[model samples]
Target: MSDKFPDQARVVIIGGGAIGCATAYHLAKHGCKDVIIVERNKLTSGSTWHAAGAYAQFRTDPNAGRMMAYGGELYAQLEAETGQATGWNQTGGMRVACTPERRREYERAITIARSFGVEMALISPQEAGEIVPIMTTD
Candidate 1:
């Protein structure tokens, strides 16, 4: 980045966190110029810095799930498009449900996720434990 800020900008974003940076990136990706991002601190130094950097492609609402699915796809291709590493990994995620009610809820989410082409599944506690050996199934 240059030290000199432009006198005028077509769009000025308020933060330098993930959302703000993503908005600017997408805008520029779509051929929009003259964009500026103003940050109170260093980039990702606020809430975004504390984030777990995990994304789930399933939600109670199918629309929200679809957006998450979009994010997963975008992260997968961001490095290739920008020639910059986003540190995104495609490791599969798991949600453990020790109770029957939570299990039902996840089943519902799986249905919603799958409805919009997001692949999610419910596995036995044993299966989940197998993936993470230190986790207890019982």
Candidate 2:
């Protein structure tokens, strides 16, 4: 960290949030030098600092789902690639549908996810209960 800011930079990014920092990282990774990030305050001191470390990969749009999948894959390998410990655990999650309409929506989502190679399935209430024994299916 340098107290003196550069007089000139080829690229100047506003904000120091996740997206901004990610953009800067990718730009530098692709050999973009003289990139400067202008933050209002310290990095990630805004909403990003209080963000819940959770992400949903299932999406109705195939392209969005694929992008989400790519982010998941990137997070899984981030620690190894950057030598920085990112506590990302890939524990498979479940979506509980309380109504027939929700179930149908889940089914449609499953189809879309499968089409883009995202593993998803709609399980029966009994099956779901078995997976989480403490959960009351009724």
Candidate 3:
């Protein structure tokens, strides 16, 4: 076990997931040498490792969509800087609509994503099947 960080450290962060590590890296890059990260498990061993790495910005809230977009960009930059694969996939995803209410929700989400400059398109059942060969149009 490593010694606890000094009492005078500028910042002390808990957890060692992608978010924590990224925060530490940015702080270090900005000349914050007194930053320390404490983790209960190996780095990226928690939620970060289990993340699906999907970059979809579809959400009903505009702010959330924008945040997701920013997160995707940060993840890309992190992978580039560390030369490690973060399993990011840029392939767009589709939310299947099984009912009228679900379709309305998907439409709202699509509009919010578009407001955040996220590229998305609405497709008919046939088009969706074309994109995902395993999916049935029914």
Candidate 4:
């Protein structure tokens, strides 16, 4: 939103959310000289504000995992590179297997994450309880 309206742009992106901003940055990085992002409000003021900023390393699809990894990388460096805080926190995530079926799903996710060089462990319920004391193993 540098200008209300840019006269010219090699790429015109709608919305100034995280996704749109990231898209604009990459397009410019890859040699798109002029990139313009139009936003109804300030950048990240939309759903980005409400975003939990969760970075899931696991994805059933390898391509999706890569995309998520790239975003995580960007968030990790956004503050350092541009001197602007992206409000990104690297808080860890957990997938609670509340039932046998959910445990199977976690197992699949673990395999997929590991296959793409992402680290994910399939821990026992007891181990999980050790990390989260309030967790109910029943």
Candidate 5:
């Protein structure tokens, strides 16, 4: 290995997961050229590899939902910018309820999503199964 390191950098990131990479990308986008990302493993080899990649942003807290939504949008744009696929899918999502209390929870989540214009829907068990074919009503 070469015993040499870059002479200078404005920012040094310690991970190569999605968050770290995204931060690096944003920093670079804002004209911060001296950014270095140090990874113990290859890019996306950490927790990001195991991520379910779900983009559901149904939250009672509007700011939290907005942040998640922004992350999703940034992920979508990242692929195009880097010429690498981030495996983003917009198939939509559903939260099922197996009991009355759980149903109320789903209702509240749907309301929150709607308030943020997040484009979600409340559906029956059958509809949920249709969206996620592997799901079981039981």
Candidate 6:
């Protein structure tokens, strides 16, 4: 919880996103103390903090998928170790697109999610509303 930066570090991570924080955690856990995270913007300013605060184990690469999966698996231990709330949950996610190109992107996303063993489907905007009441197809 120290906001003051150190003079130097052996490893410098560019972002304070989940992945960067996790890397710092493991590195510190393994007895590496000279690690620093440099976030150009404020902490949690990236997709990891925004984007509905969703956690996904699905990724285009198998290794990436496994790493995401590992993050969930490690969450309990992380919270226990740091005595902090991870804010982790299983609420799932939703994406809405008004343009044809955006819809096509979602279509492609579905395929990628499926390939990564994620259970997702293309649902109507009303159906999406069932998941996130504030969401709209319009």
lDDT of 2 by residue, 35-112 (tens): 999999998888778776667788888889998888788789889999999889888789998988988888999998
Tens-digit lDDT string for candidate 3 (1-138): 447647666798898987898789889989997888889978888997787554466777878889888877776687788898866667767788899998888888878777777887778999988888999798
Identify the superior model by TM-score, candidate 5 or candidate 6: 5
Error of 4 at 35 (Å): 1.0
lDDT tens digits, residues 1-138, model 4? 453677877689999988898898888778987888889989889897786565676677778987877777877898998898767787767787778897888788778777766778888879988999998976
Q: What is the TM-score of each candidate against the true structure?
A: 0.90, 0.85, 0.80, 0.84, 0.78, 0.58
lDDT over C-alpha atoms for residue 59 of model 3: 73
Per residue, candidate 1 scores C-alpha lDDT tens digits across 1-138 of: 789978889999999998999899899989997899999999888988887786677689877888888888999999998899889998877877778898899989988888887878888778878889999888
RMSD (Å) per prediction: 1.5, 1.9, 2.9, 2.1, 3.0, 5.0
Q: For residue 50, give model 5's deviation from the true position in Å.
A: 1.4
CA lDDT of every candidate: 0.87, 0.87, 0.80, 0.80, 0.78, 0.74
Cα RMSD, model 1? 1.5
Q: Per TM-score, what order, best first?
A: 1, 2, 4, 3, 5, 6
Candidate 5 residue lDDT tens string, 1-138? 346777777899989988898899889889997888889988978898887575567776778878877876776787888898867777765566778998888777778767767777778778777877898776
Q: Per-residue lDDT for 8 in model 5? A: 70
* Candidate 6 Cα errors over 4 Å, as ranges: 1-4, 59-61, 92-138
Please report the TM-score between candidate 3 and the true structure: 0.80
Clashes of each: 0, 0, 0, 0, 0, 0
Superior by lDDT: candidate 4 or candidate 6: 4
* Cα lDDT for residue 44, candidate 4: 80
